[model samples]
Target: MELHNVDLNLLVVFDHLLRLRTVSGAAKALGLSQPAVSNALARLRRIFDDDLFVRSAKGMLPTPLAQELAEPVSYALEALQNALNRKVSFDPRHSDRDFRLAMTDIGEIHFIPRLMGTLRELAPGVSVATVRNTAVNLAEEMSQGKVDLAVGHLPELTSEFFQRRLFRQRYVCMFRPGHALDKRTIRLRDFLEADHVVVTAAGTGHARADEILARQGVQRRIRLRVPHFAALADIVASTDLIATVTHKFAERSAKYFGLRYVKHPVDLPEIQINLFWHSRYHRDPANQWLRTQVFDLFSE
Candidate 1:
């Protein structure tokens, strides 16, 4: 296709349509009328010589070619946006940029309260959406601008991701007050014998803590494998079930739940919880400001 044959703006529409999976959503996000977005979609189809999206009961479904175009088109548009918006100053006190983040439930519970306390004073206009729907494709989502940042021990950080280490995360055993092992110092044997409630890996059936334990040849009775840390608090407070959680989260959980924490008897290496973003957004001013706030929050 010739350079003049393609309109770059249509690619922006396509990118949003793919991200949102609906023409009306793309229209709303792009500040364009639904007919305008529909017109752009029609032009995109003719230009690419393919039906870019199919109207579905769910939403607009991208064709294989449109799916293939999603990445590079998104990258190009973001790079162009960054170039154009580079000098745009970010005033947190007044700017209403909505930051989308991909964070685990543990990170959300552990960080949001403190982060919001500061934001409420400094960046009241700024809003946030911490999305968990993209955990399986976090790196891709960040690169595409679907997620602005992510926090946690992201084992998926590859070359595509840029991360800044925030804090080293260590595990602790938490249980109700006056449980079987409450007064006694926990031995590795006692921990292994206790029934436990574990948080499964996001978007999967396995739990990283369990995987680590299994690698060390430790056998424990897993009474439940939940998908989030929020659920563990109630279960641990009522049953013989003990929970292994990151030290910070465990410490925080103790404030609300009648729980006590002890050092994990086994020598599990500390994992670093880092702030991660796509390299594509490295130079974006709003993203830079948000990242700075996150760094400051944890550093203090």
Candidate 2:
């Protein structure tokens, strides 16, 4: 019962014995010799004053005392293992880590394919999960480590977070290729006269496109309002509606969607896309590796 009398190795031996139920099995599990496992068990018996496991024809069966200590010992050992891994260096080539990212729908379209390709080549064992930045309590989720990283133009992730700029992109007006306004330069009159499909992507900086135009006293004939950028291409491709979106997204999606994009007439400022992480994970080896991969892959 003395605080400093117990050997930590004995607990390791005891835990393996309870699970494997044999001295030889415990020794193999712990990479120790059978005699070493037996010696540790003997010390454990002296410390606890009980025969922890009894030999039998079937296998080594645990005594009631061993059964009582089994759950707590396993939990303690697992907790210690997690603590060590948190401070240890991360090896992406061999790590089977699952990381969660916060992004908009446009981000999923523009970032996932390239990101996944890079990960498949560099860290085959690592996996990814994505959550929309509009999720409830997103800030709190990142703070408590539920979310690993947030990528895009997220002005909300300001304080208590560290961010690195990946790139800056301007908004461009996109429409079907053969539409009436297919000229190289779009006039302000033509832009305002055309029916528009506005993306009200709340909780994202993309929404600023409409705000910037409105402040400049430029208003387009609103034909549709969608919540995400996913359907914008298909809708604009099949109709005469114009959609203003980030240049990177427009450039990537134009070919597949069969749409054409031109510079905005209202002079919208470029939005800087950033990679953000909670301050708590700023020094984590795994997080640092992930951040570096993203920056190298996309930063301009």
Clashing pairs in 1: none
| Tens-place lDDT digits, model 2, residues 1-300 | 874888888888888888888889988888999999888989889999999899999778999999999999899989988998875689989999999999998999988899999999989999999999887588899999999999988888888999999999988888898998887888989988999998898767787777778888886799899988778888998988888888988887677876888888878899999999999999999999999988998899
* Candidate 1 wrong stretches, greater than 4 Å: 1-86, 133-136, 203-206
- Predicted candidate 2, C-alpha RMSD: 9.0
Q: What's the TM-score of every candidate structure? A: 0.68, 0.71
Q: Each model's RMSD to truth, in Å? A: 16.3, 9.0
- For the record, the alpha-carbon RMSD of candidate 1 to the native fold, in angstroms, is 16.3
Clashes of each: 0, 0
> How high a TM-score does candidate 2 get?
0.71
Q: After superposition, how far is residue 239 of candidate 1 from its true place, in Å?
A: 1.6
Error of 2 at 62 (Å): 31
In candidate 2, the residue pairs with backbone N, CA or C atoms under 3 Å apart (3 or more residues apart, or in different chains) clash, namely: none
Q: Per-residue error at 249 for model 1, in Å?
A: 1.2
